[model samples]
Structure formats: structure tokens, C-alpha cells
Target chain A: MNSPLFFLSYFVLSALVLVTAMAAVSFRNLVHCGLSLAFAFLALGAFYILLGAEFLGFVQILVYVGAVAVLIMFVILLAKPGVEERRWGWRDLVGRFAGVGVSLAVFLALLISVFRSPSLAVKAPEAPVFSIAVLGEKLVTEYVLPLQATGLLLTVAVLAAVIFASQEVTKK
Target chain B: MLEDKSIYPDLREGRRVVRPGGKREAKPLNFPARRPWLTLGLAGAAGVFGALVGVAVLLFLMEWLKPGFLGEGCFLYAALADLDRAPAILLNGFLAYIASFVPVPPILLGILSALIVIGVLIGVFLSLFALTSVVERKVLARIQNRYGPNRVGPCGLLQPVADGVKMLVKEDIVPAGADRVVHFFAPVVMLVPALLVLAILPYGPGLVPMELSVGILFFFAMGATTEVAVFMAGWGSTNKYSLLGAMRAIAQMISYELPLIVSAVAVVMLAGSLSPEKIVETQAGYWAGIVPAWFVFTPWGFAGFLLFFIAAQAESNRSPFDLPEGESELVAGHLTEYSGFKYATFFIAEYVGLFAISGLAVTLFLGGWYAPSPLLAFIPGYIWFFVKLYSLVLLAIWIRGTVPRVRIDQLMEFAWKFLIPMSFVVVVAAAVWHYSGGGFLGWVVCTPLLLVPYLLFGSAFAKKFAPSGRVYRYSQG
Candidate 1:
């Protein structure tokens, strides 16, 4: 695993992910778009694997592919078989312009920062055995307070969902 | 019609046989009758055959083309102390896994050895599908109670197999207006992740075929894959019922998953590792009655177990949270358009997911691979693991039969209001309790501490947020 080869794989996979993401936003058929999204998610996972982040890769696939994409498709299917848009409308054209402009601007900013500083892109250390043990141990022991905070956040989310759901019901 | 019970012998497509007086007649079996031994034998055989052929193919390729490629895939062998670079072991394992699909007899002894320890997993999977059908039938029958599939096998044990065959033989219909590619791929996409998840699972001690360190995360990821696949199935079918079912499923699974992960975090906290094998090992050892030797015995242990169990059930799309396939309102939910083997895939995937969840529970909370009592850790891990795993499997069947599916909103509220927050509180309390230790009672006392908050302020919460049942009725009218 030369860093050069690693960087090459990363570039290829990242491009694949981008291509898939583009298909997701650009596809005419909603189902096709959902699939494209899943593919992008999966490609991102492959990128994670190449980066030696197997768990992260698994998470990307599991979360985006397993749950989110299916959900979006599911929600879309609830409506009748809507006709596909044949051409870009006024809003579609304006939206794409805004999106691309914003994206390019952000990319240029990042590029400028990288070029000017030339310090952020540090070579990573080769640390082996970043197994579940290391992650779990770090999460519980070193990051205990934050872990506890995550619990609180989850609990608050639950309570909020309950309260909001209840409010919605009572108003009805 | 009354007398001629003699049935078809080929039995591929729902045929029957008749006994004329004294002679023994092979009865008119249902399409998917309880042929447990047969199904197990065949599937197990198939797995072995597939593995052998797969090995031969790889080695053949290596000899023919690339000599070094075979050595690259052997992560385990590479880790071993004195193993040479001969590609046999790696190729053998691959072949055995692939050999699972072939039909061969001479390899039975070797197959048995290969299936060893992990057999309980395959067994648990097959049984989950079998028993869930039985339980669902029994429950539906009890609700209506004329006794459900009892006529088929023992308490209608053979019913799932019958159902499976029947589903397989039935007309394979793809809805005309559906997304052709997604529709075709949905069931497979859903099922492959479900089945693959089993590969990384450590059913008991020495039972895991592949012991990846990121086991829990991998398990969660697999669950997510199934979720996406189900979403695809529902949408691809192009049916209103399925689409609605998929939405409910998505919402419900997403909401419950938060709590589920929180509960799992509790285990990662306690067991101190994410590997399923490590979790089980952490739980081994004793107190007074063999120390109960499971994470379920800690201060928040019982509460965590309950939360994890309920969430796991919900995650797997079982009762009383089977909103994904609200059969009454949504036909077969995500599976409405599926027929034959495609439908069967969904059915078995559900069962496999159920088994996987239970196996994880046993691993995380219930001292997996360790005996019912911690003292029996000496008795080999897979046995204890399967013993408890099977018990949970049975319990799942029992619950399926005994309960009815709830409304979508109610399901979400129950998770949000009752299970999720409670699990979160319990997780923190458990961590604190683990730090400040006494006995099981110290851990158990956290129960009253948590309940007191809800018990006291619950009225205010109740008043502001109307329960789902009332809301459902109000909306319907």
C-alpha cells in the first residue's frame, strides 16, 4: 500500500461516488435517482475501505444504502406514478446554476486554503489494530463525557418527538 | 370428491396422495410442508457443494492464470504463525462457502466439520423462518382461535416450508408499471445483506467463521442494507399499499434504530469492545448463582435487555411493530407484487434478520456462547450460545403468535416515549452504576430512579401529547 496507490484509489472511488451522486440528482426517473443515490453511498463505502476505515465504509453503506435511500424511494412511491420531467423548467435551470456556482466557489476556497497554507494535508501515521476494541475503548474511556452527552442528546430527541407528536395529535 | 384422496406423487406443484384402506399413502403435503430435516439437509448440502466448487474454480484459475492472487485473500492465514503460502486453505474456505450450493454426498463428513459450531446459526435461521410462520399462524388462530397450522406437522411445524414451496410455485408476477430493474433486484438486495450479516456473527465460542473487529457496526450496517432493500421493494412494486407500508416501515425503523443503537452503545460501554466474540467473553464469569453472567444482570441490565429486545423486534419488523407489512391495510406491504421465490426471499429474510438480532442479544446482553449459567463456560461456547439463541427464537415465535400489530403512530410514540428515552437514561445510569458498584440490587435500584421521573411528570407529558390511538381514530373519521 504505497501512499501514491492509496491516493489513486481514493481519487478513483471519490470520482465514482461523485458520478453516482450526479446521476442521483440528474436522473429523470425517481427510482433511477434512488438507485443512483444507493450506488453513490456504496461507492463512498468503498472509499472508506481503501482509506482503511472498514467500519466507516460499512456505516456508509448500511445507513445510506440500507435505510435512507429505501426511505426516500418509499416516500416517493406513496404518490401516484408521477410523470417524469422531460425538460428543465425555469426553476430547475435557476436551481442548477445556484447549486453549481455555490459548489465551485466552495471548492475554489478549499483549493486556495490548501495552496496557501500547504500544511493541512499532513501524511497520516500508520497505526495498526484500530479494531472495534480501540474505538470502543476510546469512546467509553477517553470520550466518556461526550458519550454521555450523546445519550442525553438521544434522550432529548426521543422526548421531543413524543412531545411534538402529542402536540400534533391534540391540535387535530 | 369425498373418497378420492389419492394424490400426485411428484409433489412439485401442490399434489396429493390417497390411502386405500390398509396401505400407507404418502399424504397430500402442502407446497411448503414442514420438511425441516430435508430443508436443513439440502441447504447445508448446498452451502458445502458451493464451497467445494468455488475452491476448485479459484485454484483452477490460479493455476491457469494468476499464481499469486490466491494468497492475497487469505487474511486469516496471513495472521497464522507457521502457515506456508500454499493457497489451499484460503481457496478451501472460499470453496466451502461456495460449495454450500452444490449437491454432493461424499463431502458429508467434511461438510459436517465445516458446518460445525456455526451449524446452530444456519439451524437458528432455518428454525426462525419455520417457527415464526408457526407462531404467526398460531397467534392468528388464537385471535380467531380455531387452532392454526397444527394439522400439518407437530403444532404445524412444517407450515413455513409448505408456505415457502407454495410461494415458490405460485405465479411469478412483476407488476406491469413497476421499475423493472429495481423490482427484480429488490428482494435479492434485501436478502443478501441479511444473509451476509450472519457470516461476521460469532454465534458462540469458536463459532464465528469470520471474526471482524467491527462486528456490531457491521451488523448495524447490514440491518441498514435490508432497510434500503425493503424500501426498494415497496417503491419498485408500484402499488399504493406497498408504498404506504414502506413509509411506515421507514419511519418506524429509523425512530426505533436510535434507541437500538443507544442500547448497543450501552453494551459497547460494558463489554468494552465492539467485537461479538469479545462481548461474550466479557460477560463470562460468576457471582452467586453463577453470577447470571450476562450484561442483562447489571444495574440497568434488565432495562437495557428489555429495550434492546423490543427494539430488535421492531427492527426485524416483527409484532407488535410489523407496520411494514400491515397485511390488512397494505396487502403484503413491501412485498405486495412479489411471488414465488422472490416473496419467499422476503419471508426468509425476515426470519434471518430475527435470528441475527436474537443472536446479537445473546452475545451482547445474555452471555453468548456461555451456558445458561456462567459456571458452564467450560461447556463450550456455541452450545450455550445456541441454547439461549434458540430460546429467544422460540420467544419471538411466541410473541408473534400472541400479539397483534399496532398503529404506525402508536408504534413510533411507544418507541420515542417509552422505550428510547428510558433506554438512554438507563444507559447513563448503568455507566455510573458500573463505576460505583455493590451488587445486583444496586443496579436494579436504578429502575425505580428512572421510573420515578416518568411516573411523576408523565401526566404533564401525557396531557400535552395525545396518545396515538385517539389520534388515529380522530384522523380516520
Candidate 2:
């Protein structure tokens, strides 16, 4: 698991994720940005697969790359593609600085938590034999409340979306 | 006729006999026509002889290169000995044997074996694509009362090969204003997911290429990527027709994907595993040693299978749901700007996508590779899988010939108002069936649950969209 090849692949995937993420943010074309975001999502899924969470990895791809990225692309395409590009102004500069500061703060907090965690000091546990059945069981049994809550929230969101869409049609 | 050909009567007669104007008959090759059975026998004999000789030569070369390569206790020998897994075993064993001589790393060997599997899958499916292309045309021709392509080869069997050559030799024209990079990569992007989806399907016992834990999820994820590819193709083409087609495709795919995945969820729930191999295994065996215990035989399974099939049809953009590529309106839709090999690639991708989805339908509902009865169990599983697959493909072709292309609004309404709700019902009924122990009580509970919604949806849709008498506003009765 700790083979040099594994580390090499890990670093490569991380680099891919970072590069794609940067491209996603910086691409001039909205569609290109969406595609780069999808690539980033795909790279993240690969990272999860490397960590042996195959279910999570696949789900990540299914949801993010498949659904979310597609939805983003649809929005970009359907929107006014002829809109003139706006020149960077003082507001944009301030927004960029604020975004960087927030991201740095979040990253530092995560880094601190990881470095100070007792689990990091202890011997790493053996990787569990991963199975979809176990994940399903855990979701239903131990994490039932959280699962139900998430389901309820998603259902509500879907209902709200339907209602909103229907209202638009009715208004038309 | 004599008056018309006053100077060249003999030449005219020869022309009339040789080149008849209408409905020219396909001439059978002379060798086969002379001795049909003998020719067939010889062909079969030659094929077997060639295969055997090829294997013998390969083995001899291997042994000559390294003495005791096929000796007792060798892993290669052990693998090759398994006749049931002959194709896979031979390829893997040969690669492993070569690796053994080369001192390659274990990881490289693993990667090589994986590549071999992928290569084999691609080879098999690409040929299947070729065969399917011709088969589809022939089947469509039959449906439409036409001769189809009888000029290329015997019964136009080699039409795909000829088409491949034509596409290869033809000029690839890209629109001047098109995004060259995206335009170029779109077909490639479209093809990659179609092939990737093929990896997770359990074609037979131990025949899956990848066998990921979340195989079905992986399939859907790969499927989702195609939407982006379609969009790329449309946007990159810089053609209104292409953009419109791509948009329609994405919308249709997104709409149908819900029902498709939802219906599959029923099978996954009932099978109790996301892994296709496990799902197939769970569906093994027959009830009372007679009827195969395929999920499609059950009430929820039947409904789910119907929903899944319909959604899959839409997903693959077959007729009744092929609004994206509606020839009358879109002029090949997203494919308008593509030409030559690029167009051929898109065509291949479409068929391959159809095959993948149909293969999934087989895996989920038709019990993967299981035979219909214990009596038929002697046949290889992959044969059964392909038999079921080809039947579904034929069914698609039949529907394409029979059904008119659906309107965009009707397509959306069907997916959203009918298929999606019906699929949810399937999921619920599946749960009910499972909790009720999947026996007589389960059937009793699930049948009415499925039937009522199906009837309601069908009748309501018919009532809403029923053709009414036209009102003549200008005419005075």
C-alpha cells in the first residue's frame, strides 16, 4: 500500500486535481471551466479510488462529474453566451484577495487539525476490507438518522424545485 | 425493341439480359452455388484446422523459446487447462508466461493482464459493432420491405468492412468556424465512455473485465460523461443544428437517466449488491428446476425491466426517442458537422452505447448469463448473455422500424410524468416483494401495485394526448 508506485500515482493524481481545479477557476470560457471542473471532479474520484473507497469514488463521479457538471454545462450553454466579457476592476481584485484569504484560513485550520490529531500520532490502523454491503448496512443501521435526514432534505429540495419550475410554467 | 436497336440488336439484347433496370438479383458466388453443403463443410473444416494449427504453433514456439514452459505444475499450464474459461485463460496465461521470461514487476504484469482483458473486450465488441451495423440495416430493410445492402458481399455481410474502408478514405471536413480541438475530441470523448461502460458488465461467469465493487454506479458515472461529450460535439461544431441536437440529447439523456438508474436501483435492492457479478450470482438457479429465477419474471422486476428498457432506448437515442438526431429536423443533429471517420466513430459509439445499455438490462433483469432452464445450463453463459443481448438489439431495431420519432415535448412528458413515477413504484414494489419473502405473497402484493400504476399512467397519457376532431374555424357548416 505504501509502495513508491502508489505514492507516485498519488502525487500525480493530486497534481492533476490541482491543475484541473486551477483551470476550472481561471478558464475564460464558461464551458471550458465546466469541463475543467468535471476533470477536477474525476481526479478527485480517482483519489478516492486510490484511498480504496471504491463506492465513494464511483458515487463522486456519478454525482459530481455526471450530474452536477452536466447541469453546470447546461446552465452555461443555455445562458447568454454573447454576454461581453467584463474587464477586471477593483471589486474583482478585492473579491480575489478575499477568496484567497478564506481558502488559506480553511486550509490552515484543516492542516492544524490533521497535525494535532491523536490518531495521526498513533499507529495507522489496517485498511478494512471494503464492501458495498457493509456501507449499505452502516447507512441503514448505525447512521440511519443521518441517512434519513439527508434523504428528507434531498426530497424537500426536489419538491421545492418542482414547485418553482411549475410556477414558472403557470406564469408563462 | 427491334426498331429501337436497328443497328446493334445483339449488343442491345446482351445489355438487356446483363443489366436489367429494376430489382436486379444478387448473384451467388459460383463456388458456393455449385456445392453448397460441401463448401460449408470445407469452410468449417478449414476454420477448425486453422485455429488448431495456430494454437499448436504458438505452443511450440513458447516451448522452444523456453523448455518446460508447459511442464506440470506451471501456473500457465494450470490456467490454460481450464476449458470453461478458455478465451480469458489463454490470453492471461500467455501474457503471464511472457512476463515470467522478462523479469517484469508484478504491477506491470497486473497492468499488462488488465490491458489484455480490455483489448479482448474492445476487439470482441468492435467486431460485434461491425456485425450489428450490418444486422441493423438488414433487419430494418426486412421491416421496411427492402433489399438493403446486397451488393457489398454475400447478403451484404461485408458491408461494414466496406463502409469502414469508405469512411477511412473519405475526406474529413471540419467547419471553418468550429472549435478545432473540442470538435476533434468530442467523438473520442463519446467513444471512451461507451467503451468504459462495457468494462463493468458481467458477460459470463468470471468474465467481467474490471469487477469494481460499485460496478453499476461506475457504469452510470461513465454514461454521464457522454452528456458532456455530446455537448462538446454540439458546441464545438458551431452549427445551430448541431447545438440544438446536442441540447436535445442532453435534456433527453438527463431526463431518462433518472428512470434508468431508479429502475436499476430496484434490481440492485432485490439482488442486495451493487456489483454486477454478485447480482448475477444472486439470480442464479431456477424455481422447481424449471423456470429460471430471473428478476424480470417477477411483477416489480417486469415493470422495472419495461421502465429500464424504455429509458435505455431513450438513453441510446433510438427511434421514438431520437429527437436529438431527428433527420427531418436536425440533419444528423450533433453529428451535422462531423464527416468521414469522425462520423463513423459517432455511429460506432451510438451502437456501442446501445449494446452496453442492453447488456446492462441483461445483467439486471434477464439474469445476466443464466440459461432459461437447467436443461440449457450446458451451454456457455456468455453465449446466453449475447443471445439475450442480440434479441434486445433486434427488438430495438424492430421498434425503430415500427415507431415514429417522438416529439420533444412528448418525449419529455413520457420520461418525467410516466417513466419516472413508474420507476419509483417499481422500487417500492421491489422493497415490498423482498420484505414479503419473494414468494406467492410477494407476487400477490407486488402485481397489483405495479399493474394499477401502469394502467393509470397508460390510460391517462392516452386520454391527455388523444387525437381529437379538428375544428374548422373558417368554414361555415
Quote the chain B TM-score of every prediction: 0.70, 0.89
Write the residue-wise lDDT of candidate 1 on B170-282 in tens digits.
Answer: 89899999888889998888788787788776754565777788888888877876667767787788898877777777778788888888888888877777788888888
Candidate 2 runs further than 4 Å off: A81-86, A90-124, A163-169, B1-46, B59-82, B99-102, B470-477
- Highest-scoring model, DockQ: 2
User: Which has the greatest lDDT?
Assistant: 2
Against the true structure, what is every candidate's RMSD? 9.7, 6.2
Candidate 2's interface RMSD, please? Answer: 1.0
> Looking at candidate 2, what is the lDDT of residue B441?
98
Can you give the DockQ of every candidate in the order shown? 0.59, 0.67
Deviation of model 1 at B4, angstroms: 27
- What TM-score would every model get versus the actual structure? 0.69, 0.89
For residues A41-71, what per-residue lDDT tens digits would candidate 1 score against the true structure? 9888888877778887888877678766765
The second chain of candidate 1 has a TM-score of 0.70
i-RMS for every candidate: 1.8, 1.0
> Per-candidate TM-score, first chain only?
0.74, 0.83
